[model samples]
Target: MRKLILAIAAALPSAAVAGGYIVPNTNPRDLSMAGSAMAAQDSAGAAYANPAALSKLEGLNVTGGVSLIDFRSTWTDSARIADGQAVTMIPKGAFPFVLFAGYGLKLANGMKLGVGGGVNIPGGGYSFWPGNWPGRYQIVTVDRKVYGMYLTSGLQIMPQVRVGGGLVYYRTTEHLIQGINFLGYDSSAELGTSGGAVSFDLSTEVQPLKTIPLTIGVDYKHQAVQHLSGHGHFDNPPPALQGYGVVDQPATHVLTYPNRLEVGASYQVIPQLLVTAQWTWERFHVYKSDVFNGGLGFSLAVNRDYKNGYTLRLGGEFQALPQLKVRGGILRDISPVRPETLDPTLPEANVWAGALGVGYEVMPGLQVDAAYFHAFYDTITAAGADQAFPGTYDTRANIWSLAVSWKTDLLQRRK
Candidate 1:
């Protein structure tokens, strides 16, 4: 576990999004314009995106790939709370590698069974200027990190139906630091949580509607939480704020990933063209507590109007050439946390992303996958921004990632 933690930690140089909130949650490889698996045979990434898809593996296949992601963010005084604003710079890039081995066994009734495991960074980070950012974002280095992982299995119930499940683990830590010259504030807060749980998914391919090949999948992960314990201090909190004291909360979040529902379908638009789209939803708003909600020290309120967010991904792939595959996709996700709840420590908003990528099978199991994503920037004005420095801040981040794959065949039992 420690080694796994170290590997994952070393992988996320930029996986940590600013304000400790991550947008563009899907693997960059899947970011093509309409984001479903264009290469269904490419089950290598299934453990992270759709475990049920593992049933598609005909034999034992092992895949190991690494992605190099570059990120850049620049902030200006879009709100002009400051007299002169500068571009706030943070660390950039991520080095995430994926390794998984899945095998499908032929059952008595022509069914198949498979399993795999994967480690991924779900995304989140902390950033702050020591002094009041004369630019967009202002004050104190409040940093936090969130990591995710999965160990999974799949079963093909029928020739076209499959179900998969995973034992998932999530770890998060919040660090609140009073940056240099951060207003008159000299105190900060800290919170962290780690736990393991289970999640399940079901998928089926049907020919019910003539030309449409329907693929429906559902995923569910309950909020059987990990308790969070931490302490907080504030030198200038209002009198109503100081009594309850150092806040200690459960390691939980308001946009707690709830039971998710997914439905998708694909159609053969032409002899060589395929189109696919998928919809996913979770009752994120059900999470009202602010990590402090379930802790022994404080009272937290679930958001009354917040709901689990939703995403719509659409894309298609065309065999532009025998060796060249062209793909494009568009994705939108309703961010769970409101801008109002966005702390300088955690900033996020609904997201809109367009992706373009291609995979070239250099030779059989050896492949090269490259993807580029353009995520529309969302504006955030946090209380922590101006309050900590009596100024204003706005932030935006851009991402680009490339990956390589080498899949090993295990069915032949090669020595």
Candidate 2:
């Protein structure tokens, strides 16, 4: 039974590792270009990726899209008596959906304005672990959901320069179930929490030369921390471990969303082709929270020591035909959680990614976009100190997106 309690402990730390959540590509067009929207963006998506882009539009534009993520992983126990055998304790895959929308308007004052928003699913993952599985005593199941919303604006300072910013909000819900061992008896508890937070984002773009189709873009976003409060229901437990038979106790937690910055450039080598590159830095070190004061003033401490993370992305778009465009790109994503902080609650690892997509000009003012992306993660083997959940994790993910955009001159003032 003691082993069961320790196993549960191994999975608990991950519940607080929310700072590692990655927002998958929300725009189908952006996904196809491997999320290289920092500078080479068109349509209303610019409202979120780089609002300054709104100033380049001719009239009014609206863009909307939906994305589906398929995440899968394989976990193994090195200490297995069967000599390093794979464990089938958890679900093999999870599917999550993302939605996005943006609108841009070109005013008569030579200024551009735009608004955009999106719904992101916490990257796909499994929350269920079998009670009889080797690691069941450590964790039975964990489920979490997070939603984000934002309103953004942009202004064109000159024909070749623009700047923009926005306010963002988030809501979160979580549920956890784990088995506990005490006095030779096995019991379980169900815990849940809900909370929200608000943050901000800023961005800018510049064109240095008029003769070259080259542009530079920079973007930044503030950090947000969610203060969650809820309760836990303890199932039947040994008398020595339970104050009252199957009672409830207060539960509270905090999740820190990291701050991030991105800088990139895009160039149109020719009238029919565009290429881009970008780098992103994330401050995941802020994910330090060893304790939380509950509703009744009791403290619950959970340690999480994480490092900063980074990502590099490159992409291109080619005008294959008068009515169709082809896109492709690649990226490298790094993880912030060190080996010691790695846990099964949400296994995270560095990844290499590739994408492909296409755009169809269905009509004079309407376009449709579709894209697919795949991420290949490095196999992680944890066996030393800080390897709280000592095991091996193989992870990978795939994403599919589709969107439609429309533009019209109706919003322009009649001459």
Give lDDT per model, in order. Answer: 0.52, 0.70
Model 1 spans with C-alpha error above 4 angstroms:
1-28, 38-41, 68-81, 84-87, 126-139, 180-214, 229-258, 291-306, 380-395, 408-415
My TM-score estimates for the predictions, one after another, are 0.73, 0.88
Write one digit per residue (lDDT tens) for candidate 2, span 152-210. 77787777888888887777776677876565677787777778899888998999998
Backbone clashes for every candidate come to 19, 3
What is the TM-score (0 to 1) of candidate 2? 0.88
Q: RMSD in angstroms, candidate 1?
A: 7.4
Per-residue lDDT over 272-348 for candidate 1, one digit per residue giving the tens place of the 0 to 100 score: 77777877666656555442333343243422234467778787778887766878887776766554544333345
> What shift in Å separates residue 382 of candidate 1 from its native position after superposition?
5.9
